[model samples]
Target: MAFVAMGVYGTLSAPVRPLTHGWTLFFFVFNTAPIIPMLGVFAALYATAATRAEREMEKEYQRAENLLLNILPEPIAARLKDDPHLIADEHPSVSVLFADIVNFTETSGRLTPPEIVQTLNAAFSRFDTLVEKHGCEKIKTIGDAYMVVAGLPEPREDHAQAMVSLALDMIDAAQEINESGQFPFSMRIGISSGPVVAGVIGERKFAYDLWGDTVNVASRMESHGRPGIVQITEATRGHLGDEVQIDPLGDVEIKGKGRMRTYTVSRGFAP
Candidate 1:
């Protein structure tokens, strides 16, 4: 499309005839008609270009949000998107679960690094599914250890119950792996419920983590727990309903936190 504006200056300057002036004006108006169509075409192209740009930007924004969600909880990820500042919140009540593969170091010695990673991923992937199924948020994984929590980043009335169910599912998942005879590894799990502070750390490669006495105790419980057992603190035990079966392990000495009563649930859930 092209817009050509005819100059009345050349004709007007050359010679002006009163009778021909009206004809000159009419011809000028006729010549400008093509310009209207040219302007319309330009406007349409601009609008199309703008719409495509907006769609591309929206897609990029969605991709960024998904990446953030993978790193943090949905609520936390939204908060981060609103403000990139440090995110720290104190949760008054939450149940944290820690699970570690028993004899990982010894087992790893028998396999290649790639093989160990593959096996660990296979086991942890199932645990990840259980975490999502039970409405719990996965905190992070350290080596052979997987950490998860219920209630915080979002609140739930039955955090402990959700945690117990997830722990049992994890146990069942690990058992299935062992029975498969492919990189068999028993899991030791520990759980604690109380106050905790959750936050995003590091300016680069930020990670969501939990801190405070509750997390520490949960970690200790896992480290001190026996293989193939789901050990839980008294705080967590109080939340488990009659539907679950637990074997009492009275007042085991915990490092840093004196003697605390603990229990183990071998198999859970009612028929």
Candidate 2:
């Protein structure tokens, strides 16, 4: 733009007619005449560039939103885009699950770090597949523990059954992993059914997460569970009914959760 302005100034200031009385200058008003047009052209070019950039940004934002919807539910993703609020959703009738590698610390000690990670990923990958198949949503992973939900973002009439089925599938998947290879990692899963607030956090690159009494109770169930078992709270047991056999685990003290009656789910869901 500066170069063009200089060129215009040079041409416009040149005199239209030779100077009178032997004045040396030939170029005059014409040299300065083109400067305004040069500036106008530069301004037009800048505006065009800015518009194109804005269009690109909008496209990128849309793509990100589409991916977010794929990972999360539609309503949640929309809330993330349309509103500036923390995207927490509370579902009073959903089932939550938590799973961890059985004796992860001891099992990890036997394998190299890479091997340990590979084993965990393989197991969690299978758990993810099962969760998806059973119409469940993956909450997140805290190291060796995997958390999942059913009928949270979107409602499902048989969320408890679906959750139990997912837990059974995870057990079967773990058995397959144990038999297929030398890795000796088994799995334990815990579940709870109640209300929780689920949402995404932060302005840039947010994560879909959940909270509430139910979430905390579910975590406690996992932390105080037996290996290769699916321990559940009374709340979830009530939802499950007699669909799956339950072995009463009696009332157990849970840190920050008080004394809660717990039970175990044995056998797979019958057809």
Candidate 3:
């Protein structure tokens, strides 16, 4: 219609007077055309702002995610996003290590709850750093006990040794804590290597967990073993080398598992 109207006006006004040629042609055909480019500019500006906003939101999400990563396993974190109510499947070839402050019950029982948390936090801070450094996923913490593992959400050949190294560092940390005379308590670490299943256990919060004989054995090693010590099963020993010196603990009879071969790792780096 604009074109038709321009044409009609051009023809009629041209004959009306000879003065309607240059500016008349320009105005008639493009009366509203100048606004198009301005609208295009506005759209571009809007799109750029939207993109920037999206990027900012992504960064914030990642920040919170990294904080969560410090606590929960990556696989469990992913599951929490998709199906926060779903269970995580078990992954084989996983190694679980259980480490705890010895006599923590007695120690914490003597202090206030806040003091217990503070002392535990001081100990756990070092443990958590070592866990992340060794690429192991922290399973959970029960009072003074810190559970950890390797080769889940991914796998590695030396998970057993990896956990062993972390356990060594944990023992050193306990000695430091003792020197400080905070509690003068020792810590025990037990590690077992084998297949296990892991997943979220409940709905309120995402809890990354493990199950199977591997988990149970790891706990047993912790319980039956001595303080300031790292114990491993024969299977774990098979996967490790002399970098970790071993003591001939021989086969020890554990509840329900009958007699099982076990060893005490006496020498190892903070590796």
Candidate 4:
């Protein structure tokens, strides 16, 4: 429109009034015709780029949220997002389970590093599934040792029972892995139920872990446990009803706790 107006103005303002030349009108029409379409093209490009960026950013946020959930409980992870300070809480009762792959050193000697990791991953991944199935929280794995807990972050009346079931399932999973004939391994599992102080520690490398005498005793139970057996503290045993079978392992001199009784549990309730 501006170009047309300019051409009309130039024609009318001439020393002698004359009709606008064909070339002048054609020039104005040709230039003005593309203006709206060019603007639309640029607008479309900007919109597409913005939308793509937004989707990418959203995807990144989802990935981060999943990673956080993997590391900590949902409630705890939400709290950290709000304020990542010291996160410590005392639970009156929570059952802790620790399972270490037996004779890992020898297994490593026989296989390459990648092979060792694959073998460990296969076992731990199965344990992870069982942990979720039993409604337990996996604490962390220390080399071949896999740790988990129940009745924490969210408490339940059946925390001990859940841990027991998880341990039994884990033992079964390990047996299956070994039965595969490729990666032969046995698991020694320990469980204890009592008061514990749980919290998130470290800055860049954050870890949600448990402390207190209960944690120590659970570790002792695992270290002293027999291979291919689910060794559990009396505290845990006390919580188990008639739902499971147990054999007395008698008393052992725990490092810090002096003498303590332990037991081995079956996969299911006694007939």
Compute each candidate's TM-score over C-alphas.
0.82, 0.72, 0.74, 0.88
Over the stretch 72-172, how does candidate 1's per-residue lDDT look in tens digits? 99988878878999999999999999999999998799998889889988888888889999999999999999999999888898999899889988988
**Residues 80-153, model 3: lDDT tens digits:** 78865767576778789998778878667789988888888888888889888988888889978889989887
Better of 1 and 4 by lDDT: 4
Ranking by lDDT: 4, 1, 2, 3
The candidate scoring highest on TM-score is 4
Q: Give model 3's TM-score versus the native structure.
A: 0.74
Runs in model 1 deviating more than 4 A are 1-12, 15-31, 83-86, 109-114, 268-271
As for candidate 4, its clashing pairs are 243-269
Error of 1 at 21 (Å): 7.5
Model 2 residue 147 lDDT score = 89
Cα lDDT for residue 122, model 4?
A: 80
> Least accurate stretch of 10 residues (summed lDDT) in model 4?
11-20
> For model 4, how many clashes?
1
Give the TM-score comparing model 2 with the true structure, all chains together.
0.72
Q: List model 2 lDDT by residue over 152-237, tens digit each.
A: 78898799899999998898888888898678867878899988888787677678888888888888888888878989999998
Cα-based RMSD of the predictions, in order?
A: 4.0, 7.0, 5.8, 3.9
Residue 224 of candidate 1: its Cα lDDT? 86
